[model samples]
Target chain A: MKIIVCVKRVVDTETRVKVAADGRSIDLGGVQFIMAPYDEMAVEKAIQLRDAAGTGSVTVVTVGPAAATKELRTALAMGADDAVHAVVEARMGPNATAEALKQVIDGREYDLILCGKQATDEDDAAVGPLLAAALGLPCVAFVHGLTVDGRTAIAEREVDGETERLDVDLPAVITAQKGLAEARYPGLKGIMAAKKKPLETVACDATGGKTELRSLELPPARAAMVKIEPTAAGMQSLLTALRNDKKVL
Target chain B: MAKYEAPDFFDLDSLLTEEERMVRDAVRDWVSDRFMPVVEKAYSEGYFPKDLIPELAELGVLGGNLDYADFPRLGPVAYGLVMQELERGDSGLRSFVSVQGALVMFPIWRYGSDEQKARWLPALHSGEAVGCFGLTEPDHGSDPGGMETKAVRDGDGFVLNGAKMWITNGNMAQVAVVWAKLDGVIHGFVVPTDAPGFTVREQRGKHSLRASVTSELIFQDVRLPASAILPGAKGLGGPLSCLNQARYGIAWGVVGAAMAVYDEVRQYGLTRIQFGKPIASFQLYQAKLVESLTEITKAQLMNLRMGRLKEAGGVTPYHVSMAKRNACHHALEIARTGRDMLGANGVAGEYQTMRHMCNLESVKTYEGTHDIHTLILGRQITGLDAFGAA
Candidate 1:
């Protein structure tokens, strides 16, 4: 199987994100950026399938400024054969990201394409399905586990309290989840080798904004964690607040 | 439909420079992807993951923490944050690095001979070889000074005789930093565990720190060349310094463990039902969760400041004592509360809280007992001698 895993460089999950003063994007001031969490799972799943299947090239593609190369190289160091960094503006919306990734994967024959269900920073989660749509392939979301056999793919998904199983064709898109597999760490030799790996830089065909952000707005302030007694009285008091103050009880 | 929000709300912009943020985030991503998923499993199985050491080395987490580079951190906070996040998965795995980076690697870097360092550091840092610290003997828990372990200077080398207990990563170690009294002066040595007379007996049936391999090291007159003595190190201060580094990291580490247990319990409380409603509706559950968050917050703040102090070179044992003690205690409490809130299921190894709760029991005792920090603070406040506190 020829698999292409799409990853994104986003704000660190633990970072204290603030809205940009312009009210159209997250403030880069204090935010620490990192590889999106689910993308990592996607990368791991792709690698696992490649290894278990005993054949295939795992290519990681990321869309961002030059800094995105680091996460791309990291994927390379973790056993990916090569990488493509599609440079795009940081303020690019989900469509821009998907379009940029699209250009990178275009005309490249691939049997399977993998992606994180969503990026933690934008949390739009549209990039995977969008890329699949742009490429015109089958798509599955919130997949907890995945496997590939010949021209078919198998996936496990969580629903309500029970887990569901899914099947799709080889030329499909899968959004990875938590239990797929644990990602492996790169050894020092790999870390050293990643610096010298063949990372190809490509231009994105974003073709401008598919969706324009008029402005970026900061989320409303969270109410301080006030003590709420978990009792009838406390429940009633909360209910009263909804009924009397915030309305819609 | 729901939208996700970020967890960072700290007004710490003024506190950190841009470069520090880059280094911190890079390390965070590395650990989250590499360590988090398998950590709970490693901890529950009571096995130190041999594979991840090199991965950590590749991320530069082992000794890159204390060294200077393009990132001139104002505090050891970067290092602290790394440990904190590692422990968020499980403490035993973090302790493995603690034993190497802080315990074994630091000493060799600080005190090893040029030859010794050249021979050992690169491999240890690369995680090619597992390293551990053996300061606590069966009889030398808190009073390492009264250690019965002895090293007699032989013809061209020294012969070591002793048994060390509760050594983290011990049974699996390729190397160990050992302290033994020599000619009335306590000194440290870098002993290869596979040396002729050296034997590492894995401690069995442990209820705590099951993920980390605990062992009793029996050096039955282990003999090695004089080169084994760390040239720059002599006396208790050497081992103590290594312990301080580990403890500083531990102070940050336990907070992560505390956060995990608290998060689990809070989630459980919010969803679990009692009396025909969510038990989170109870004031008692709220109190438990609130107090947990309160402690976690305080510990986080303490560690953040402590990191800066460490980077600023103003960090002393007392500085580390404060954070380590608080974090250890809170982590233990949080784990216990987590188990309690979950009722019988908490005791099972399925959830991470029970394992961490059990592990913290050992973490609390090692590096320095919780009571040791109380008295270290006491000594700072009042000029009183308290060997009795030991």
Candidate 2:
């Protein structure tokens, strides 16, 4: 089965983020970027499915600025057959991003399309459902496990702290959850081969979407710890403080 | 915990190719995620992290630079980068890869017969069969040309008898690339560890490179067929060539150690308060950090150029000796400065600066000692053998 995985590049989770001078964006100076963690799982799952079939290709597509090619190349290094880089502005919303992906993926022959449940940077969780809706195909969100037999695909999704198994026909969309698959580090051979793999760069005009940003700020600092004595009256005082001062008794 | 910030004052990443950067990053991430967590335990307990062999093989680190059918052959620069990242985690880890690739698999690929290559290369590449190089003997180290190991011609095979000391992976090796004198001339022999009369003893209580395995190998009347001998290696040149390959990697590897120490001390100094301010505010501490960074940057450039030249088949043994000598000397000094900069906290295991400082002592002595390399370069430059007067 042929598979296509959609990925996004975001600031590395380990980096200390700073709000930009303009309150609407994040500061990009001297920050490192990586493929979103869940998206890595999606790419890994696509590769596994392609390899298990023994006669198929896995292609990764992304819509971002020119620098997104790094993440696309990383997907190729992780054993993806090829990559599609849709060069556009980095601030594209979910709808416009899905439209750009659809424009490129429309001409491809694929039995499955996978995406991360959400981008770690934005935490929008909208791109997969939006893309599936626009393509008019069945979608399984938060897929934890998946298998394919002939024309039908079975996906195990996480819902309300429980697993829900769903079987869908071929040519369906799936958004990978945390446990979908563990990504593998790229071997040196794969890294060398990735450079020779086909990477087709296309100019995309899909820019604006319905969502708009207002402002961004850091979370409030945590309150300092308050120590209480171990005596009965101290316990009573603690309870009184919890009920009276904090109002959470 | 904060992420490791590799010191790159010279913007060396800009000079690297995409493949080089990706390869380095892959190993760096692996070291951070897997190796760093276990390094202290392994070092304190004095055991090599043998379980990581399969993972390293999966990452294509073993035999990574050889040109076998399935091997990566990632070129010298990429291989050097792999060494750099591994050494950044710990010297013992890098030593394992060096011994496996440059010393063991390389000789088999370059000199062994087709049958021998087909037999051991795949196994070693996959980490199914661990291999060790047996050339440093009890009586011979700096001058391996005078090795006393004998391979007496007997029937259709040969009977070997000798002892090799300071053998890395000796206790765990399934095969050994042994160099012995055949009719008073050096020849390479591939000996299986399970052969009769072959014995291995692990050395204990080492203060340096404690996370690595070091053993003494004894061979008493061990017999091998004629096919066991490497067909192409005829003299000391064979083993010396392998040392050159390893030294090229060492030149790059030690820079990683220096960078690690430098980065650690720099971070610590910035936050550590002394005299009502961060200790980094002092000019004396700044001098140490500045010197460390400068030497590491120079070492990085030297190794990168050496790797490129090696890829182009233009690197000489003299050049490798120079790079190895210079890099090791400066790295050791930097580790010392970093250890002292931490003051009372330097000796604690919580900070890896002292661990790196101890490991560099062995790195300075192995492959080729800093002084030996200096003599080799001295002889090359002046066309005079420094040892001839003796």
Candidate 3:
């Protein structure tokens, strides 16, 4: 089955960022970009399925400015069969990004569409279901266990703290989580081979959306952390502090 | 054959964290199922298992040591474990990957020109291009400064002449990184194995390291263009650094051999009945088995710390020298002791101790001789230049 996994180019999780002058925009200057952590897990899961089956092709799709190609190449390096980069000439958020990806994936039929439940930085988990609704396909939201047989995908997703099993139809959309699979590192050979693999970029028409903000803003700073001691009296003191000064009780 | 209990926490099947444990177990599985069965037949029969190299490459087991935190793996300790398992099957099998990953691919990744790195590393990493390091000459083994491999200035290129002794994988190597004394300076030459005037003859009738493809290399009037020279390398330090890098790997590798041998003895002592009871019931057998565990643990911890220190940018030649000496010394002793526990069968080809014992004799002697490391450590502990201008 042919599949397209949507990956986002984001700051590496290890990066510590200072908020930009504008509230909603992040200060990105000189920061290193990597495939989003959860997205890498999704990519690994897709590639693992494709490799294990030994018959299907996996195409990685990313939409952003010119710099988005780096994420596509990284996915290719991690063993994606090919890539389709929806080049956005203008700035785009999740809605536009999903729209652009849907447009690119529209002309071609995909067995399944995989994405992360949420981008770590943004915490928006709407993309998979959004794309599923747009494509008019069944949505497999927050899927943690996935396996393919013939054309159907057998998967389980957590609902109300209990896992609900489902046999999703082909051409469905699923968001992957950490439990899906441990990610694979790009070996030296794969990194070299990635350079030769096919990456096709097509111009994406802007199908804009309605969530407009007058200004970008940053959240308030996190409270400073204080060390806690482990002795009995120290532990009692810590409990009192948590109930009193910290107000965590 | 003795039953194996948990193999002293270095079995790798037990040593790594769960995720990393899976990776290590995968390596052993591949080694056992794919490489091990084919190795002895190839080595004793004097053939190189050229096909298996790519298999190793595919698993990223070849130079899989390059650090990346996102996909954490068993590092130097596991690397040592993998190499040891392969070498336990046969030194030739281990050397094929080692020479490619540790000796050749490592240098290209670290010191080659951009185009060279882009060109050679991927091919070697994938097992398409086989590489052999040419540093030891007929005259020089440990002290490569005494090397007489000559590279004379000729236009934009150089002509090389000199013979190399005991080159592992030399016959089957498609490309060789030959170290030569250029003018009065030392330089590394990436000579094609099929380069004009470069010839290799496999040394025959070997009692030790018989599983490996070892050869005496002759480079008579061999010419290489200036582009063939490693651009980022200079001086005797260039090749010595490579040897130091390789020796660190060997130090870790020998510990693995020692562990396997020790494990064999431990199992043999428990099963082989003598005096109408198991030999392991004897105080003497227990002593040998316990000693093997103790020393192997020390070496395992040492190599693990060495790997951490290396990743932290804290490695020195002295640390590796100390490790190499201790591990090789203990390995040789362990092999001999393990062989005794097996009695007549140890010397027989049915078991692995005597073969390991024989192969380790060569391993201990190469990279840096055990005695040479003793002096290198002596120089470190005491401010003495023993192997100095005399």
Kindly list the per-residue Cα lDDT of model 3 for residues A1-249, writing each as its tens digit: 677899888775656677678765678865656788788889999998888888788899888767778678768867898998887755566777677778889888678889988777667787778888888999887788999988789998788999889997897899997798777655434544566789898987766654654565556879998787788988998999989988999
Is model 2 an incorrect, acceptable, medium or high docking prediction? Answer: medium
**Residue-by-residue lDDT tens digits, candidate 1, A1-249:** 789999988887877677777777777874556678888888888888888988888999988888777688768767787898887765677777777777889988789999998988768989888878888889998898887878999988999979888789879989987787677655333444566678898887766567887876666889887678999999999989889988996
Angstrom error of the Cα, residue B165, model 1: value is: 1.9
The local lDDT score (0 to 100) that residue A65 gets in candidate 1 is 84
Which sections of candidate 2 miss by over 4 Å? Answer: A220-249
Which lDDT values do the candidates have, in the order given? 0.78, 0.92, 0.76
Identify the runs in model 1 with alpha carbons over 4 angstroms from their true place.
Answer: A1-249, B1-45, B66-75, B388-390
Q: Output the number of the TM-score-best candidate.
A: 2
C-alpha lDDT of residue B75 in model 3: 58
All models, RMSD in angstroms:
10.0, 2.3, 17.2
Clashes of each: 12, 0, 4
Query: How much is the lDDT of residue B296 in candidate 1?
Result: 82
TM-score comparison, 2 vs 3, better candidate: 2
Q: Across residues A140-240, which tens digit of lDDT does each residue of candidate 2 receive?
A: 98999999999999999877888899999889999999899999998888888899999999877686487778899999979998889999999999999
- The regions of model 3 sitting more than 4 angstroms off are A1-249, B1-6, B9-19, B66-78
Q: What interface RMSD does candidate 2 have?
A: 0.9
Cα lDDT tens digits, model 3, B210-329, are 777788889999988878889878898887787777777777677767766877777777788889999899998889888888888888788778876886889899998988889888
Candidates 1 and 3: which is better by TM-score?
1
lDDT of 2 at B272: 97
